[model samples]
Target: MNRKLIALDLDGTTLNDVQQITSETHSVLNKLRDQGHIVSIATGRPFRNSHYYYKQLEMTTPIVNFNGAWCHNPSDKDWDYGYHKSLSRDLAISMLSLKDDPEVQLIAAESRDGIYVHGDYVPYPDFFPDGVKVSKQLSSETLLIDPTSVGVFTNTQQNQSKIEERIIKHYGEAVEVRTWGGFAPCLEIVAAGVQKAMGVERIASYYNIDRKDILAFGDEENDYEMIQYAGHGVVMKNGNDKLKVVADDLTGKTNHDNGLADYLTNYFNL
Candidate 1:
């Protein structure tokens, strides 16, 4: 194999049921490194949120976080110099216009913190827990700005699709709507063309690894494009079907079963 780099998505693929790495994964990864392969993470989480996990795995490669909004080495003291996306107050307000629709949940994201809600009237100070910073109430009356990912939640799958469709029809040109997780109808808005693929591409380009020589593994709708760009993409058995379709081969085991480690050990002869 001409593979030199590998990008692994965190959620449904790498992180298991208890939200952690498998021992077998760590062992195999060490073995891979002994053979001179590069490994990295492509995730939707922020750097702070991902630090503990990175340390736990003893990861030294760049991390693609916030769906590729940030791509830098979290291990470095300076978190400077990486790709990023910032959502403005106006976009938050525009999203607020649709809050009357019970199906829509508007959220705004800040470069530094947890999700926030958008509003007009003064909500109960306790509407959110302490530590979540609100943008502030505008004089326009009844408007509130909270940094969060807008979502459409419903008990009914069909209604979920309808709601997603609505958001796309209205904001398709403005923002990108992505279905979160495998087979989950919940939708989250991200910067247009922003996903792990963007981050992975940036890192690969910097290292001069051609797209076809890069290996990636993932298991969600967000991972679709990532698999497309990598040369030796693998999908966990539990991954979303779309991911499976593009993966060069199927690992045939889930994270709970230590599938990734098993596949690497055997396929790469590590």
Candidate 2:
């Protein structure tokens, strides 16, 4: 078989319940890498949070972070095929309107530069281990540059929907808003037309690989584009049914059972 580009989605697809890469998975991926196959991560997580896993897996390729809102080669900072599609500064600052809503807990804008938070509460501390949480709030002075993405954390799904609806109604043309895949009732907003597939394609092009050789595995709404774009998209047994319908194949096991590794072993006969 020809060399392939394997793109992985971190949460609920690559990582197990505890958010660690199991030994079996690590072994299979390393063996594949030793065989000349390329492995990379395409996720909704910011580089701050995903960097550990990238280093843990010992990946040397560019990462698609923030669901393709940012892509860069962390191993080789000199690698120039990087891109960051940020929301306009005006748009980011405009999100401040939601901060005062009683149902809204937090509103944050993130970029490689840093995070600008506009609330008293921090929703997921693990996701922002190095963030400077303050009651200070996001302001034009604090968020000077355009941000790669904006996150609105709400207290409930109903409130989340209300906020999402308002965002779409007002800025539908300029941004893409999605309900984050985590258990938290939050909304993730990125520039319009951005998706994981865009970054994966960029990586494949750099490697001179064709679409037919791209193998991607994912399990959520954010994975929709990449899954459809890959020549072979594998959805886990525990994946969303919407993805399963469009995916080329389905893993017999869930992430907890090392589903990605299982599929690779059988497919490549490793």
| C-alpha lDDT of candidate 2 relative to the true structure | 0.87
| TM-scores, each model vs. reference | 0.79, 0.92
Candidate 2: tens digits of C-alpha lDDT, residues 63-109: 99988898899999988888889999999999988877898888878
Worst lDDT run of 10 residues, candidate 1, spans: 120-129
**Each candidate: what lDDT?**
0.67, 0.87
Please tell me which predicted candidate would have the highest lDDT against the true structure. Answer: 2
Question: Residue 36 of candidate 1: its Cα lDDT?
Answer: 76
Q: What would the per-residue lDDT of candidate 1 be over residues 64-177, giving only the tens digit for each residue?
A: 876676678766646554656654446655655565666444343434344444543322222243434544332224333433344333334455567667777877676766
| Candidate 2 TM-score, C-alpha based | 0.92
Quick one: best TM-score, which candidate? 2
RMSD of 1: 5.1
